[model samples]
Target: MADDAVTTGPEHTDEPVRVGLVGAGPWATMTQAPMLTGGPETRLVGVWARRAEAARELAEPYGVPAFTEYGALLDECEAVAFAVPPDVQARMATEAARAGKAVLLDKPIGLTLAEAAGLAEAIDSAGVVSQLMLSNRYRPRIREFLARAARFDTLGAQARQITRAFVAGPFAFGWRLEYGVLHDVAPHSLDLLDAAVGKIDRVHATGDTRRWVALTLEHTNGAVSQLALTGEVPEGGYTELAMFGPAGELRLDFRDLAGDEADSAAGWATVRREFAAAVRSGRPHALDVHRGLHLQRLIDQALAGLR
Candidate 1:
């Protein structure tokens, strides 16, 4: 399926795109649900989750109906924002796209390359617009940094992300504990590196344990990037992504940014705005399903190398 062939949906005559929230998890509560409810270009019309009680609880506060059936929610909404596990997200996102709904998805796309590719193909074949919510990509400062970095002679980059969330926090899911930081957090770092330099052509990765993984990526643009990821760090973890050249280096540290609440909310709001604009314009966003598939392939390669 061709990139430009994807359409958002039928014209809405200036009405805001009705968006449904899927998977009423911590992320949905903290970010996706709030963004859709408050966003100017989108309206939160309904919510669905595997747990009926959870879905009802999430929907009650917003006054939107809790859908017992996933398809029923899809039927009422022009777009779907997913906050589910990767495997569930892969399945439902494919279903949503096949049903002609625009998709706003969480990162990693799916647990495996095959799953990711299938979702991408489904979205493309159905001619539906899609965007993966890589939070850093939606940050204005990060975007500005990438734009400026593009002007410089390319060299190499380094990214380090250390978090304690997997050890104990609202984000500490069993899947994250099983997969570790490589699968849980590296997608954000990889996406940032790809945006700053170019597409990755190859990857070499290794780790002694699930908690720590490192990767060296060879970008198609001749730039290389090294990433170190861990989720067993001490409280108040560190994150830094830096790109270098003869002009010196540019870097961003999440610690230096605003609090998580404000920063995360703002980032998700940008995601909502971009998704809404894509739905309106029928133009694919830069962070589309194909990009998710590419990242998932890179991740799969890294995982293979780890074994």
Candidate 2:
């Protein structure tokens, strides 16, 4: 293990990991930056972004220096939390991992399978810790539910996410508008489904002009899932994931929960805390880059079917 070992290895120590923030977007400003600054096991030392002015603005309140050069920021910190777009994050995270810096990444690790594979290769080669920010995975309730749900013989599952994210929401990114809900929101649903049920083997999908997408996933464990996603919904749309087995059924209603600011904040805080623990302990998080790649593959399959 090198001095900057990112994954669980001989290089891990009990010292607090120095972390940096990458990307000065809304997500970075609202969640990643604050959580890194306040996390007990991690110190937020620097910030960087493609836009230097945005980086300076974000780093000012924390009294951290904003780096115009991304590599300079990587040099100042042992780990990086990326709040950039999927493509940008994939490129930067690959570089950071190659530099032996641990990475905390956002969902849909990459826009393409090649990018995701490249990131996985970089992380594996560098032996650096990499965690994806799948918000639901960090929720205590969701974790407990998945644990209990996994015990039974999962028969089937259903995940439905209908949101007006593009209509009028904080997640008004151009990518979200262009790609619709499958890329932006389906990753969460798919990740939760994979955790509760099993790995996805194959998928068949169909959708309409309204951006409504329905997918039937065949899980390797003999469990099947129906996932429906759409961004063209009224404000305060519906979101839920239900898994059924011989024992019983378990369902999570994320509609109201996601709309709750306090709950969302708490989820992000837990994500940051767990990420910090991973950096210090060198233990790979449950939602690691490999898992992100798996989800990305599923996303790619679903998108392909849609086309």
Q: Residue by residue across 1-307, what tens digits does model 1's lDDT show?
A: 0012123443333678899999988999988888887756799999999999999999999999999999899999999999988989999999999999999989889988999999999999999999988887777666667777667666888888888867877888767777777668989888777777777889999994367888999988888989998888868678898878888987877777757666666677777777888888888887899888988999988988988
TM-score of each: 0.92, 0.90
Q: Worst ten-residue run, lDDT, model 2? A: 1-10
lDDT of 2 by residue, 258-293 (tens): 567766666766776677778777778767899899
Query: CA lDDT of each candidate?
Result: 0.83, 0.81
Q: Pairs clashing in candidate 1?
A: none
Error of 1 at 229 (Å): 0.4
Off by over 4 Å in 1: 1-13, 260-265
| True-structure RMSD, every candidate | 3.6, 4.5
Model 2 residue 142 distance off true place after TM-score fit, in angstroms = 0.9
Instruction: Give the number of the best model, judged by TM-score.
Output: 1
TM-score of 2: 0.90
Query: Which prediction has the highest lDDT against the true structure?
Result: 1
